[model samples]
Target: MGAVRETLDAVRLVDHHCHGTVAADLGRDAFESLLTEGEAWPGISPFDSPAGVAVRRHCAPLLDLPRHTPAEEYLARRSELGRREVQRRFLRAAGTDVFCVDTGYAPDPLTTPREIAEAAGGTSYEVVRLEGVAESVQTAGVEPDAYADTFRTAALEAVRRPGVVAVKSVAAYRTGFDLDPARPSEVEVTEAARRWFARGGRLDDPVLVRHLLWTAVDLGLPLQLHTGFGDSDIRLHRADPARLTDWLHLTAGTIPVLLLHCWPYQRQAAYLAAVFERVYLDVGLTLHHVGPARAGGVLAEALEITPFRKLLYSSDAYGVAEFFHLGALAFRQGLAELLQGRVDADELSLPDALRIARWTGRDNALRVYRLEADGPEDD
Candidate 1:
């Protein structure tokens, strides 16, 4: 316990994937609403769940309250401090030095990457969502025949933007990973664009989705794929990272493919990370939702077959700063407990345990995301 605490406490985390905190102060209902991926119930409260409980247990102390503070009291204290102060406290407490922010999820007002970096006293980079950029191109009215080139140019331009370090895709939510693994032909993409444009709605066209994904692959940047469990939009069976095996084989060695928030399929995700050189996995949103105690078990499963270098840390936390703090806390506590147990049992030496801890907490992400020597700026 002593060794584990010392090693983990000294490590600064690179939150490889997460979203910005909401810009405005939240009411109790508003705050609780962000706690779960599911729809809010008419009478039931979000605080009845594991993540809510974890927040009370862990994040309460950061807010200057006792551990296990009641949700009512917690929200009141948060409201009194105002949003900026709350963000400042949680982000700083997380011990995260860098944030790789995905700025595409919700329409809710949120702090920009620059703002989050300011709040956390860290540096931040952007992950351009492939789907979001494609939708924007579509909305801007591209001719069906020109959609492919237009999208290609737009995506390339986006990746070249200052601070844009990677790309992301929500294909798991849109068309799933069961699509044809081969890149679509220009004719096929044009036809798909025609169909999508004719339908006149959000880009759910399966063919176009495939086109978007393949384009991301060609961009040669780390691509974060939303896999496993998520909000109601995800089809559980289709969201499995293993479904992308065919695609993985096709895109192998091309770019880093990160599977995010893999919960039930974490073992499967671990298997992929084990077999595929470019594959990596992170149990971010899942960690805080499962709470600190159970987070060890989840991290253990993810680590079982995964190469130590293939696993990265992320919060997948959106709309709230409590998640940033809780995600880091859960990962630190869980990884420490697991590695420390191995050291105690003589399965791993102290030096090896400390090395593994540092690799998972910081070095792995730094190398994967190419953040080496790109340290955060002083606030």
Candidate 2:
């Protein structure tokens, strides 16, 4: 117990897939909204939920409050500290060594990758969102005949930026994983672009989406796919990573394909990771949402058949700074309990448990993202 817990406590994490925190101070309603994947409604508060309770139990202490502090009290204390102070306390307390931030989804002003690192005390790398790049190409206006080449060029250039480590797709939100596994031909792309340009809003055209995904393979960077359990926009059944079996097979041997957040479908995700050489997964969003108490259950399901090296840690912590602390706390507590129990039962040894802790929390991310060559940024 002492060995594994101590090892994980000291391990510095690489948040392989996350989004920026809000730069502005938030009121109760606004802060609560970020705590949930669902919208706020009358008679319901995110404070009553698992994620909210976790914030009070776990994050309260970081803000100089006791565990299980009441929601109103918690927010009042946060207000007294100022948003920047609150953000600094939580981010620094998270002890994350590197942040691979998805710099795309910004409905509100968010800290940039550099700003996040500056606040959190570590290096920050960018994860380009393929959908954002495609939409940018749309905004820049490309001829339908040239749309395929134009988007490909834009995506290519986006990943080539300094400190850019990976690319992400919200295909789960935009279309779903049930699309045809084959890459859309140039003619199909041009035709889709013609319809898309005429409609001119969000890029949900299945053909164009396929083009974007295939282009990610061509870009030669690890690809992160949003799979399972997001907001109302996701058709849950279609977001299952198993639905991506055909696509994964087609893109085999290209680059690492990371499945993010997988909650209800974690077993399905585990199956994919066990079978596919390049497939990897993290139950990031699930941790803070389930809270530390239930994190072990979610992690157990995710590790049922997932190869030891295939699992990674992430927060998927967007909008709120408390998630940064809660996510890491849950990971440490849940993983420590699970691995320590295995060692107690003689199913695992202490040394092996410690190694697994390091791999999942930090080393695997550096290996997958190829960030090892950069050495320690603090050095």
Which candidate should be chosen as best, given lDDT against the real structure?
A: 2
Q: Write candidate 1's Cα lDDT for 255-328 as tens digits.
A: 99999998899999999999999999999899999999899999999999899888899998799999999999
**Residue pair clashes in candidate 2:** none
List runs of model 1 lying over 4 Å from the truth.
373-379
Model 1 worst lDDT window (10 residues): 370-379
> In model 1, what lDDT does residue 288 have?
90
lDDT of 1 at 40: 91
lDDT of 2 by residue, 248-302 (tens): 9999999899999998999999999999999999999999999999999899899
Where does model 2 exceed 4 Å of error? 373-379
Provide the overall lDDT of each model, using Cα atoms, as 2-decimal numbers: 0.90, 0.91
Model 2 RMSD in Å is 1.8
Model 2: what TM-score?
A: 0.97
